[model samples]
Target: MNPAAPVHAIVLAGGRATRMGGVDKPAVVVGGRRMLDTALDAVNDCARIVVVGPRRSDLDSTVLQTQETPPGAGPVAGVAAGLAVLDAEPGDRVILLASDLPFAEPTMVEALAAAVQDADTVFAVDESGRLQFLLSAWRIGALTDRVRSLGSTVNQPMKALVPETFDTVLFRGVTDCDTPEDVERARGRAAASPVSIAEARRAILEVVPPLPPRSATLGTSLGATLAERLLAAEALPRIAVSAMDGYAVAGNGPWVLRDDIRYAGSSDELELADGEAARIATGAHLPSGATAVVRDEFAVVTNTSDGPQLSRSQDAPVRDDARRRGEDWHEGYRLAVEGTAVTPALVSAAASAEVTTAGVRGPVRAHVAVTGDEIRREGPLRRGQTRDALGPVLPQFLSWCGVRTVADTHLRDTSDSFDELFREVRQPDLIVIVGATGGGAADQLRAALDRAKARIVVGRVQCRPGGSQVTALLPDGRVVLGLPGNPYAAVATLLITVPSIVAALTGRTPAPRQLARIANASEVSGDATRILPAVPQPDGTWRVDPGIRTAHLAGIIDREALALVPAGAADGDLAELVPLPR
Candidate 1:
């Protein structure tokens, strides 16, 4: 490749595949070639390729795999390592590809590269409009600066880097292969077309289920559908009591003219005779047989021996404030509608309409297991050791979807201890392990999960930053999620996977909301869904504010929302924003 046009592609392939019987995953055969080979083939035509992983000797491509900076640092570190390698060639951009992506398309790479002419980074978008981060392209300089400032730590999720600081481009095509099942699925789909519209549609339908029937009183998230929790109350008749300081009367018959009157108080014993009148306060009841009410200001008061008598002023007309029966309530009145998101106004309306408790399904609970020898509470850090940063934020992220952490415990990443921990936290709606998911002596999360007597459904997702994520459904109705130990990858996993599971469990679908604006240029290569962190601007647009990738707790505290940069976006793409539920 020409030196000036040295746009190198970095393929991340260092994840340990404990679910694949603890074998080398990138070397696994897919489409008659090693997974790495397939990924290189997809990108070789785009630019010079660099492989990022622990062992590059096994890879067939001519690309160089630099030992990960801050060994076992995480996906952000892996990206940083790749960027560091490409740093030698100033002005040269780096296109990132995950080795497990068997369904990557060259068109996406071209699109992303084309988009970078105007933006800082270009990311790929899947057919469903989600951004694919791993399969992305970035300018070497900015990415390197972000990595250096953020630090390449396992706890710092790479998505947290996305904020208003980076400009992004969205493209289509960066499907990744995270697990055996994902590889199989991609193979099955690849046999058809790289970007098969039909396959994309089918995948979307399979991933997102139809909404369940809702009640009229259910509130809605900003961009989510409203529940019909208050609809049942529509059958009841409603009366609109004056919401202001005004009088109520019937607008029938000529206004009665009277001078002497009795003030109706709480004493129900006081009754009005036919053609009689009374003086009433703002909320006082009108006298019987009185058809209209004349304001005290419009009335001429004459003091008499008995009491003050009232008569309408010469130029003032008698005003009528009537409360017609059933005026507010009528047949065919819609108390609420389907797909309408709940808001304060909706809640107030439901309350005014006398809606009682609303029926709502609770969110699905997910169990998280953090395993490591170095894990410690956040406090004074020992030299060469740090605290478990992801511990605090992970729970908060889950809580937003109403999914509570059933159990959280730290264990040594040993097969035996992991087995015990898994057994203890098992039976939750979902089980997530933070560390030891990758291949290493201490990385035993996937191994322990598989060894359990529970039926394990292990597979990887096709995307960047979190491609190594492993998910399984245990035989005992528990979902196990194994995340990379790196802080950045862990956070990304939570952002991408936890939300979906929570939405599934709580019946709250993940919907996009306008949270913030992108401040800098950030783009992805081919089509791949990418999620990033951002700070919300005063005007409601999210500014891409990068966060440290090593500390999960720190990142969460600093960032307000997750900005989703879609695949195939260019410099000025309007990425979808999902506010971190607090």
Candidate 2:
């Protein structure tokens, strides 16, 4: 095989699985992933992947997609259609695959490539001695010739394109699902279980579509993710400038010093001929004929017969302290890629690159509503009234997570309080409702969501102290993030879950996981995944307060993070750490 040649993939996914009742077979979920995703994973190393089927909304927008000449004609016709849109050299390789192969491995393609060196095509032989024609690799040139030789590709059996003398390699994981029983058997390989915290987060990320992006000045887009690549509008330091407070010298120093002093922001035109030097301040535009900048410390100035002259110190090391044009970035150079968070540093970098406005999703504007008739945030608290501890500090916690809290209000416990909040002229992208998530007489967030025709992405999480949390999408595109009423539970759930919602709303890349070995994981672990207050040790491990109360945030006062200790965790197992605001 030519190593320099590129390999392209054609995933045949348009087949009408009549035996499976015409369901989208490629989209069938088994082992917590779509079968089409499995197929795509197998071809991840290819130069490009072309899926021959109807455009799938869930598929990555970058993937090339097309359909057979007549939809669902056959795999042979699907191959011809895929080749129509495929961009590849005749010498490059092509890996044709069926989307229903849940167990297919990329190694199968490698093995086929090795065997196809001696033949035009190589097929994989399943354990049952049946050849999987679709799970094969082909020489692009030979495959195209065979395809062109055929009179008509429509309704043709895949076997018709097979060469008389093709090679075969026996490999496991070549299983294909043709019936419901087959899919069941594939799913049966993995144990059935309730969704874990990790699973819940993944579901929210996959299900929540990103909000539309809008152009905003970088000053107003802090914490928002870049919807498009941030390219430099113009070069950084658009002109050559001095990097130090010194003289802009031409040729070797010991030159005649000019009277003009170029200060920063001095746009007055200046120039220096050979054997000349001009006093220049740091960041000042260099004179027309300047070669380098000699710092004050590196140069000695002497009054000459005609004028002052500049010369380098005998002990000074050689250095050119001149910042050239485009030193930081050139015009049109990409400063940040799509999905990058607009951090403070990013904002400054964009400004340096002369990018003033960018298309961004959000720094996620959220309105926080504390629900309960008895809750009070005032000078005095009456009998049966509790001080609102969560409402005031929720914004600080949200700010730490990059969400901007726009409004904070108390929601009355009446039936229409939440209904009215939903129907009001909504401006914030998210409504964080603290309380009313559980099933109770006063808990009406769920009912209000139903009345508003909202889609509940997460009805309840499976973690302790925060199991009643909910995440829903309103019809008008606002997200309703319901939190538990207890201060600590609400905080813990907010810290762990809000990041995902923010990313879903703003298209921000989810922050990388922060994991630390839990020194006392076994002590805090419970029947379900436990979100416990944890303190860090000097040894870089974490310890949890297993007996801490979740009713108030006092237990976490001294803790630096919340350790997500899985059920049945051992003493030193690694646990994900959700950092507390310092």
RMSD of each: 18.7, 10.6
lDDT of 2 by residue, 410-511 (tens): 999999998899988399998999999989999998889889887666676668988888877788788889999999999999999899988888887788
TM-score, predicted candidate 1 vs. hidden true structure: 0.51
Q: What is the TM-score (0 to 1) of candidate 2?
A: 0.71
Model 1 per-residue lDDT tens digits across residues 1-582: 223455678888775565666576777654434677767877777556767787655555566768576665667777777766655465667787777776666776676666665666677767776767777777776567666777544646667555454445554454666667777666555433322221222232223333344343344332234444345455323422222232323343223334433343343433445444455554444555445565655656666665544556788765654343355655445776643444467666666566644544433556677778788866787776657777766787676545667677777645698677656664566677887766678777666655774432234554445656665445554666778787876776666566555454444544654533465425442466556667766665556643345444456556766666656655445766656655
Candidate 2 has which clashing residue pairs, if any? none
Per-model TM-score on C-alpha atoms: 0.51, 0.71
Candidate that would win on lDDT: 2
Worst ten in a row by lDDT for model 1: 193-202
Q: Highest TM-score among the candidates is held by which one?
A: 2
Candidate 1 C-alpha RMSD relative to the actual structure: 18.7
Stretches off by above 4 angstroms in model 1 are 1-230, 234-240, 250-359, 378-385, 416-427, 448-458, 462-464, 513-519, 522-530, 535-548, 552-560, 566-569
In angstroms, give how far residue 298 of model 1 lies from its true place. Answer: 7.9
